[model samples]
Target: MTSSPLSPYLRDFERLADLETSVHSLLSSHGQEATFHHVKAVAQKAAELAERFSGNVEEVSAAAWLHDISAIIPNRERIAVAQGLRLEVLPEEADFPMIIHQKLSAALAEEAFGVTSQAVLSAISCHTTLKANASKSDHIVFVADKIAWDQAGTPPYLPDLLVALEASIEAASLVYLDYLWEMRARLKVLHPWAKAAREALRADVSKLQTDKSLRF
Candidate 1:
């Protein structure tokens, strides 16, 4: 299919279904069965979040499905692949190329799946390390990915994050960003985007709290 932005609702639904099927085949053929399952879990969570948070479900689901599509590229090759794609290779990504998969996935979503919508591409690009001023779709996918994390057991932060989710996407984002912030020391490198996202979310959450106080 030719690359185009999201279409009207009906077309989007058909296209999104095709995209999901294609993602499954791609991941499975690449021996990324576990990642495939994780993407499905994230997509489910993203749909629920879109409902609760008033996000665009179609765009959010597309990003969720394509967020890790580039995992087929080995970590060692990620930097070179990103450079070849002309994607910006952040200093942090060069040191830990695994972090660059999000950008590669976004590229694949556009190149292979014809996902040209900026909303979907932006969300896919930042699903791992959310950027400052994230859109509702970005917030939804980011939080949903964390909620349905690929790690073996249940995410320990799920409970608190869920509570925060009930308040707002920004609130839930803050919860996860804060967790990472607290553990920044152990992280290979705290991506600048993540740091900016955390600070932005802190401001957003504070405004929410202040608004609630005024409503009382």
Candidate 2:
């Protein structure tokens, strides 16, 4: 299905309720209360950003709620499950399989949840480490997830991230990626998608700044 099957006129009054119900039930059944709460927070934040940015709110909300549905899978089996689903296994995913949950979650969103929108699936596929040329909905969900982080306290980067977000979604994404790049030494392996995304954002943001400088 297309990235957007539901009309913008319907807003959150339609599929969002059923999607939330299904996701909540699945997470509860798995005893993943923390994940359920985190997804809810992300969905809320995503919807808000979608409205602010004139993005596809329905697609963003659906992806946000389902983004972490695969977290219940044990990290050890993540690579296996991703392979079983016929998802590409990056070298980084092989070394640190936990990173594959994003892809697994997208697969499950389609297989189990019956989600067909390519936009929604794509957002779910890269919510953790956003890819290059991400759509507006992708940016919305990614930034929302960071804004509503699962940690006990506010994310250390939230203040800076929010400031960047006010400027543009790409800027906010770059802010988070910059943090990840700074902490790369501690990461098990840096996913190539994330690396490419950071470089793309750097170039995009620099060009935007340069264009603005020229205009003024």
Candidate 3:
């Protein structure tokens, strides 16, 4: 697949460098080196997958770099920032404030960085939990995010987690759903989006199980 025409605009090395510097500054302010490293890994993975998929390499790279821009702010501040930018978000989803970072990122891309393409914005927003009517770009970014290969030092099960994601979207979604359930149980905060994501994956799991039973 040929990359979108927007590729040139995104691949400007100077622009990407500025974005990286901005991200580092934001993370430094929050004293969150872990988050910075995670985003950097995600960006690297996004770039590799974008090249393979012949995606708009520049747009995908930019999206990956800025996907978590709003996460540096406090949870309460995130909501206000998102609202100020006219980003859409659900009230119940407010608990995991970082989730809104995706939307805020798109806004920043447009207002601050002169990015006006919907494809770029969609790719960034859908990197976490996907929304309905996702485009090919969205799917590419989503898969890249799930299969990021920088977890070598993580627990043994982490590799398996990536393997499961690569094997099937249903399997990956089920695993994510289970993980979310455990998080909610332990955190005592039932984020609305988290619940919704679990329910969606649960339905997928049910369908898969039913299909397997029929096959047997």
Candidate 3, residues 72-159, lDDT tens digits: the string is: 5566676776665556767654656756766766665665466777888887776676554455566556656666533455443355
Per-residue alpha-carbon lDDT of candidate 1 for residues 135-196, written as tens digits (9 for 90 to 100): 99999999999999999888878898989877788888888888889889999999999999
Q: Backbone collision count in every prediction?
A: 0, 0, 0
Query: How much does candidate 3 score in TM-score?
Result: 0.64
After superposition, the stretches of candidate 2 with alpha carbons farther than 4 Å from their true spots are 1-17
TM-score of each: 0.88, 0.90, 0.64
Q: Candidate 2 lDDT, tens digit per residue, 1-216?
A: 433211121133222348888787777766788999999999999999999989998899999999998876778777766776577999998988888889988887876678899999999999999999999998899999999998898798899999998888888999999999998999888889999999999999789889999999
Clashes of 1: 0
All models: lDDT? 0.85, 0.85, 0.63
Model 2 gets an lDDT of 0.85
Off by over 4 Å in 1: 1-17, 208-216
Ranking of candidates on TM-score, top first: 2, 1, 3
Q: Best-fitting candidate, measured by TM-score?
A: 2
Any runs in candidate 3 off by more than 4 Å, and if so which? 1-36, 50-59, 72-76, 93-96, 132-157, 205-216
Residue 112's lDDT in candidate 3: 45
